[model samples]
Target chain A: MRELEERIRREGRVLGTDVLKVDNFLNHQVDPKLMVALGHEFAMRFADAGVTKVLTVESSGIAPAVFTALDLDVPMVFARKRKSITLSADNYTADVYSFTKQETNHIIVDKRFIQPKDSVLIIDDFLANGQAAQGMMEIITAAGANLVGAGIVIEKTFQKGRQLLNEANVRVESLARIEDFVNGQVVFANED
Target chain B: MRELEERIRREGRVLGTDVLKVDNFLNHQVDPKLMVALGHEFAMRFADAGVTKVLTVESSGIAPAVFTALDLDVPMVFARKRKSITLSADNYTADVYSFTKQETNHIIVDKRFIQPKDSVLIIDDFLANGQAAQGMMEIITAAGANLVGAGIVIEKTFQKGRQLLNEANVRVESLARIEDFVNGQVVFANED
Candidate 1:
C-alpha cells in the first residue's frame, strides 16, 4: 500500500480539479510489478471474506483484478461495457453512467459466471462517482450472489462514491485514498 | 502449453464455423492460474528477445499480457479502443477492424510510454484476423520503436492472420495453434 501511494505520488499527474492521471503505471501503461503488489495487498486485506469470485469492469480493472484473483486462487470475472444496451436473457445487465465521458453504458455479466452459492469480491482501478461499483453490485444481486466487499486501487474520498457504497452497507477498501486535489497536487487522506 | 490445450478442449465452446468462444477462461470469466501459466509460457518463449515492453489491446488482452510483462520484468501497455476516433498529437492511433463485431475501432497508445529506443513485444489473447496485432505493429513503427516479436495465446492457423504476419516478416509464437473447428471440436495444428 505504501508502494502504491508512493508510485501514485511520484508518477501520477493531476489534471484540472479532480482528475488524477495514472497512465504511466496504473491505467494505460501498466507496471506489472506494482499491479502484483497491489493485488497481493487486496488479497491480504480480504483473505477471510470467503471470496469465490473476483468481479470488475473491463479494460482498466482487468490487470489488478486478475492478479488479485490469482493470489486469492479464485476465478476473475470482468463485466463487459456496451455503449448501446441489447437486452439478453443470458446476462445480468446494469446501466452505469460515466461522469467524465458524460455517457451511459451498460455493464453486463454472464449469468453462468456468478452463482447463488458463490461469494463475489469487486475490484476496480478508481472509485470516483461509484457508478461502476454500484452497477457491479446490482449485477451480483440479480445473480443471487453474496457480495463480500470492494477492493479499489485509488479512491477519491472527496467524492460521493464512498458515501453511496457506505449507504448500501458495502465494505470498501482502497489502497490509496485521495482527500483532494489542491493546486495541481494530490492530498491523500490520513497522510500527516 | 499442454495445460492450455487441455483447457481449450474442455471449456472452449466452438460457435458456428469460425468462432471459438473462450469466454470461460481466456476472456470473460478468467482462470487466473491458467493465465499465469500462459503468461509464463509466453515470457519463456520470448525470453531471449530483449523485450523492454509488452503491448496489447484492452479488455481480453490485459490479463495475460500483464502477467507476461511481470514475468519479463517490463511495463505492459494496453491500447485503448475507441469506437469514434479523435486524432491527437500525444498518441499514436491505428484502426483495428473486429471481424466478429463487424466494426472498425481505433486503438490508441500514448507516445510517452513507447520510446524510440525501446524494444516492444506485442501480446494478445487471439490471433485470428491479426487486425489488432497489425495495428499495434503500426503504432510501434510510428513511434520508431523496435519490435522483437509477438506472443499470441491462441492462434487460428487457418485464418489469414498468420499469413499477414508472415508476409510482414514478424516472428510469432502462439501457445495453442488451432487448425480448425470440425463439427464443434477444436483441431490443433500439430496434433500427433
Candidate 2:
C-alpha cells in the first residue's frame, strides 16, 4: 500500500476535486511490476477468503484483475461492455451506468463461467461511485455464486462507494483511499 | 505453444468460417496460468528484439499484453477505444474499422508513454484482417518509435492479416494459426 500511495503521489494527477488520472501507469499505460506487486498485496489481504475467481469489467480493470488472479492462482472473468459476436448466447447480463460516457451499457458474463460452488472476488482498478462493482456483484448473484469480498487498487473515500459496499455486507480492501483533493494536492484517507 | 494449441482445441468454439471464440480461457474468462505460459512463449520468441514496451488495444488485449509485459520486464500501453476523462488530452489518435460492430472507432494513445528510442512489440488476442495491429503501428509511428514485430495469440491463416503485416514489413509471430474450420473441427496451418 505504501508503494501504491507513493506511486500515486509521484505520478497521479488530480483534476479539480473528483478525478485522479493514473493513465500513465495504472490503466491506459500499465506498469507490469506495479501490477504484480498490487496483485501480491490484494492476494495477501484476501488470502483466507477462498477466492475461486476474480471478476472485473472490461478495458481498465483487466490488467490488475489478471495479475491478482495470477497471484491467487485462480481464473479471472471480465464482463464485456457489450455483447459481441464471439460472446456465447448463454450469458448473465446486467446494465451499468457510466457517468463518464453518460449512457447505460449492458455488461455480460457467461453463465457457465461462474458456478454456485465457486466464490468470487470482485476486483477493479478504480472505484469512484461503485456502480461497476455493484453490476459485477449482480452478475455473481445471478450465477448463484458467492462474493467473498471486493478488492480495489485506488478508491475515492470521499464518495459513497465504500459505504455502499459495506452496507451490502461485502468486505472491501483498497490499496489507496483518497480522502480529499484540495487545489492540486491529493490527501489520503489515513493521512493526518 | 503446444499448451496453447491444446487449449484452443479443447475450449475454443467455432462460430462459423470466420470466428473462433476462446472466451473460456483466452478472453472473457482467462486462465492466469495459461496466460503466463503464453506470455513466456511470446517473450521467448521476441527475446532478442529489444522490446522496450508492449503495445495493444483496449478490452480483450490487456490481459495477454500485461502478462507479456511482465515477462519482458517492460511497460504495456493500451490504446483507448473511446475518449475518457482520465486520458490525457495530448495523444496520438487513429481510426480503426471493427467488422464485428460495423463501425469505425477512434483509438488514442498517450504520446508521453512512447519515446522515439523505444522498441515496441505489438500484442493482441486475435489477428484476422490486422486493422487493429495497423492502427497500433500508426500510433507507434507517430511517436517515432520502432515496431520490432507483433505477437498474436491466434491468427486466422485463411484471412489476410498476416499478409497485410508482412507487406508492411512488420514481422509477426502467431502461436496458433487456423487454416480452416470444417464440420466443427479446427484446422491449424501447421497440422498435417
Candidate 3:
C-alpha cells in the first residue's frame, strides 16, 4: 500500500480539483511489478473473505483484476462494454453512468460464467463516481453471487463514491485515497 | 502448449461455423493459472525478441497482455476502444473493423507511452480476421515503434488472420490454432 501511495504521489498527475491521471503505471500503461504487488496487498487484505471470483468492468480494470485473481487463485470475470456477436444470448447486464463520458452504457456478462453461489471481489483502477462499481455489483446481485468487497488502486475521497458504496453496505478498500488536489498537488486523506 | 491445446479441446465451445467460445477460461472469465501458463509459453516464444513492452487492444486482450507482461517483466500498454477524459489529445489512432460487431471502431493509445525505440509484442485473446492486430500494428507504426511479434491464445486457422499477418511480414505465435470445428469439436492444426 505504501508503494502504491508512493508511486501515485510520484507518477500521478493531479489535474484541477477532481481528475488524477495515472496512465503511466495504473491504467493505460500498466506496471506489472507494481500490479503484482498491489494484487498481493489486496489478497492480504481480503484473505479471509473466501473470494471465488474477481469481477471488474473492462478496459482499465482488467489488469488489476487479472493480478488479483492470480493472487487469490480465483477466476477473473470482466464485463464487456460492447455486446459482441460472440457473446452468449443469456447475460446479466446493468447500466453504468460514466461521469467522464457523461453518458450511461450497459456493461454485460454471460450468465453462464457467474454461478449462483460464487463469492466475488470487485477491483478497478479508479473509483471516482463509483458508477462502474455499482453497475458491477448490480450484475453480481442479479446473478445471485455474494459480494465480498471492492478493491481500488486509487480513490478520490472528496467525491461521493465512497459514500455511495458505503450506503449500499459494500466494504471498499483503496490503496491510495486522495483527500484533495490543490494547484497540481495531491493531499492524501491519511496525511491530515 | 499442450496444456493450452488440452484446455481448448476440453472447455472451448464451438458455435455455428466460426464462433468459438472460451469465456469460461480465456476472455470474459479468466483462469489465472492457465493464463500464467500461456504467458510463460509466450515468453518462451518471444524470449529473444527483446520486447520492451507488451501491447494489446482492450477488453479481452488485457488479461493475456497482463500475464505476458508479467512473464517478460515489462510494462503492458493497452489501446482503449473509447475516448475518455483521461486520454491525451495527442494519440496514435487506428480504425479497427470488428467482424462480430459489424462495425469499425477507433482504438487509440497515448503517444507518450510508446516511444520510437521501444520493441513491442502484441498479445490478444483471439485472432480471427486479424483486424484488431492490424489496428494495433498501425498504432505501433504511427508511434515509430518496432513490433517484435504477436502472441495469440487462440487462432482460427480457417480465417484469413494468419495469412494477412504473414503478408504483412509479422511473426505470429498461437497457443492453439484451430484447423476447423467439426461437430462442435475443435480440431487443431498439427504442430510443426
lDDT of each: 0.95, 0.90, 0.88
- For candidate 1, the docking band is high
Give lDDT tens digits, candidate 3, residues A25-136. Answer: 9789999889888888888898899999999988788878888889999999999885333444699888888888687788998998778999999999888888999999
Best by DockQ: 1
- Name the regions of candidate 3 deviating beyond 4 angstroms: A83-89, B83-89
Off by over 4 Å in 2: A83-89, B83-89
Q: A1-192, model 2: which lDDT tens digit per residue?
A: 999999999999998778899989998889999999999999999999999999999988888898899999999999988733344569888878778768788888888899999999999988888889999989889889999999999999988789889999999999999989988888999999
Residue lDDT tens for model 3, B1-192: 789888888888899988998989988898988888888899989999999999998878888888889889899999988532344568888888888978788899899889999999999999899999999999899889999999999999989999999999999999889988889988889843
Give the DockQ (2 decimals) of all models.
0.95, 0.87, 0.83
Q: Tens digits of per-residue lDDT for model 1 on B1-192?
A: 799999999999999999999999989999999988988999999999999999999989999999999999999999999998779899999999988899999999999989999999999999999999999999999999999999999999999999999999999999999999999999999985
Tell me model 1's lDDT, rounded to 2 decimals: 0.95
Question: What DockQ does model 1 achieve?
Answer: 0.95
Better-scoring candidate (DockQ), 1 or 3: 1
Give the CAPRI class of candidate 3.
high
Best by lDDT: 1
TM-scores, chain A, per candidate = 0.99, 0.95, 0.95
Candidate 1 off by > 4 Å: none
lDDT of 1 by residue, A1-192 (tens): 788888888999999999999999989999999988989999999999999999999989999999999999999999999988778899999999999999999999989999999899999999999999999999999999999999999999999999999999999999999999988888999787
State the weakest 10-residue window (summed lDDT) of model 2 chain A. Answer: A80-89
